[model samples]
Target: MRTLTLGTPRLTAGLDQHHRVDHTAHRELHGPLPQLGADDLITLAGLGSLRGRGGAGFPFARKVRAVQTSVLRRDSTARVVVNGTEGEPGSVKDRMLLTRAPHLVLDGAELAARALGSPEVVIGVADEGARAADPVLDSLRSAVDERGSGTVFRVVRMPDRFVSGQAGALVQGINGRVPLPPGTPRRTSESGVAGLPTLLSNAETYAQLAVLAIGGADRYAQEGCASQPGTVLLSVSGDTVVETAAGTRLSRLLSACGLSSARAVLVGGYHGAWLSGEEMSRARLSRDGMSEVGGTLGAGIVLPVTGDTCPLGETARVLRYLARESSGQCGPCVRGMPALADSFVRLLSGEGSPEDVLVAAGIGEGKGACAHPDGSAVFARSALRVFSEDLSTHSLTGGCSRPVKGELPLPDGYDTPAHPRLLVDWSRCDGHGLCAELLPGLVQLDRNGFPEEPDIPVPGPLEGDAELSVRMCPALALRIRAPEPGSAR
Candidate 1:
């Protein structure tokens, strides 16, 4: 990823020339990490009004205080987690920090550990497997060894799935469990990672802390908006990571990325809302600014939708991907997501109404174990509103002239060639023959009137029928699982 800056770069200062700033270079560039106690760190954070660069924008000082309280009350050591799991396909700022400027992130993490009196700092990066090794992890490991700091640092690989970056999921993965949020919500500050008070924040948040520690509150607040001082890292259109002071206009960032025009801009990632051209002009690249324009600077993703592509079609593709990416631990993932994806697809093809899309978008709004459902709903609804004209054309006469140009990015192999296979949740099957009747060619009823050859891959011609079978099943036992890498077809 390329790096750009709108103003004097702090986090990205030395990144322009250096491929990876080693410990020696890092020290020279930013000076040594300053020692700070818990109270001192909290004071600086409060002064800066620092918030998690992660999607939530939670107050950093509040999180620090929470972890401190938990530690004092339980008499337990706190763990500092540097969440570099940039799972949102639209964002790469965390990865940039880890790969290009690893020491900055480490300095921040180490500083936090020292202040909190924590013995260990855990940094989580996406596990990309053998196909592509994450250099970020390697850089982090090397940076830790180079520092030779007293603080113990462990760099661990996490699943690259979208929801795996959630605080609970990250803690769960570090604890050797599946990296999915627990069914019941729990605060990581209160009890996280080995049942101890944990201070977990996005990687950039930690880097910002290091910046604050080095520059002090006054210098840190010199740039950016007064409300939220300091610079923010944005993954502009998934191609460039730009570090700019807070409250920069959205148009300036887009122009800096060489984007001259766009029909609309998808602020934040898939979970974020879309701003129309008009709204985009007025949008500011800050938390409050985004909210004022009915958007969020979620994870600092800014993607523009140019006129060359059909926005509705692009949204349908993303909705389908989000539906597939769900953790499958809640009703939203198991049913609502697929239904919403199907509705959007139909809408894109001009076979379904906008009402269908709206209703499907609301299926599991506040009922999921995580915010995935709510975020997906927000994304879908924003698309409907921003692309109302294109939606109207599609609803009236099928799709528009433009084809589905994939301006938005997904991970490698996201478009894997695989057929949809029928999966039967036997617990809910109840031996209903509705599936077999709906997909006569793809599914067959056995002696018990349950689906036979449930593992069979539906033929391309019958994939539609297979989906229909799933939707029509009275028991809601049938689902279509997309083919995985080594799954039997």
Candidate 2:
């Protein structure tokens, strides 16, 4: 396979040489990883101004210092975790780093472990089809056996869901629990995995760390822009992988990718904003640069939306996937996501009101345990604003005069509609009458103050109120159950 690339190569320097880098090849391409004290790591990271490759864009130096300080305060060893779980459907830089350069990532993990005085390192991979991550798992095992590194490396498979890759959820999974974000958000660096202070970062961040350690700060800074130094791996259109300097212009990248013209572009993944062709042409590929234009280089994804595809229809499909992927732990996410998705679908079909879409999108923000709700909300809001003319056409006349070519990529199994049924646990019910009061339309009080749900599945119209009632239930007895896959809807 040919690797399409631009700018300086550090982490993916020698991927063209081999499928998987063995210990020997790893040592050859990048020499021995330098051992660093905690202070040294912070210094190098600060000098390079390295940001987390994950969606958060947190400073790497601050994160390292946080873990070190936390471990010292607790008087315990810190556990280092490499988050290789590329859960974002539109991103694949993490998987590529793991698959082609697992050893480089391990080298960074080992460095972090040494700096934190830890004995173990955990590499978490997304458990999707398993076929995509199999090579990385095999390479990890091979590296462990061949290198005989003193540090204990464990490979854990994370849940394939979007929110499962969150640092807290990944830690929970590593601790042998279902990979879901805790209701009360906690910093994994403060307390994680067997209650030890943990240092966790994205896979590409670790690979970059390895590069910084081996190549030294001065050499690393030679590449990329002043604000952000070093190279970034981008998964363009889910097919072509490009390694470019941080400040490369989006227009230049697109030109290199052979797209002469485009209607619009999505900087970042699904959570990121949409930019017009002119705006994107002027925007830079770096995080800071993209931010200037109300966009983000989140998860290293840059997908162009060609004029032929209907942006509204593509957006509706994505919203549908996001709605289906909701963790169901949060009421707003469970309810608001479906409402937003269904509303978008209706709006696309020229049947729904734009006000309902706006309301659902507004309600979804900041109401969940994680960023899923907020991200989806941002995506929807951006879509509505970016495609205003299209919305006008659909709303006024009920037609855009264009067919949806499905330009945006939606993964398999997420396209199916969610047929949800509400289930109430009689044992936990105390009959405070709040659920019935909140959603009188969906829940009716029986003789014994028990709630009686309708015989049919909860209709989409009542979903918002139903979820609110579920959330407000004093006994936590209410829950929504989705139909099993391939089961009768």
For each candidate, the alpha-carbon lDDT, in order, equals: 0.84, 0.80
**What lDDT does candidate 2 reach at residue 280?**
81
Instruction: Give the top-scoring candidate (lDDT).
Output: 1
Candidate 1 lDDT over residue span 1-489, tens digit each: 789988989999887788888889888888878888999889889998999989999999999999999999998889999999888988889998988898888889989899998889998889878856667877877887887758898877897888889899999999989898899999999989898999999999999999999988999998799778989899988888999999999999888888868889998899999999889899888998999999999889988889998888788777767766777656555567766877887886689988997898788899889998899999999988888898889888877899777888877655442246678887888886877666653465789887765565443435777788888888888888876663210
Whole-structure CA lDDT of model 1? 0.84
Which portions of model 1 miss their true places by more than 4 Å? Answer: 416-489
Q: Report the alpha-carbon TM-score of model 2 versus the true structure.
A: 0.87
How far out, in Å, is residue 314 in model 1? 0.7
Worst 10 residues of 1 by lDDT: 412-421
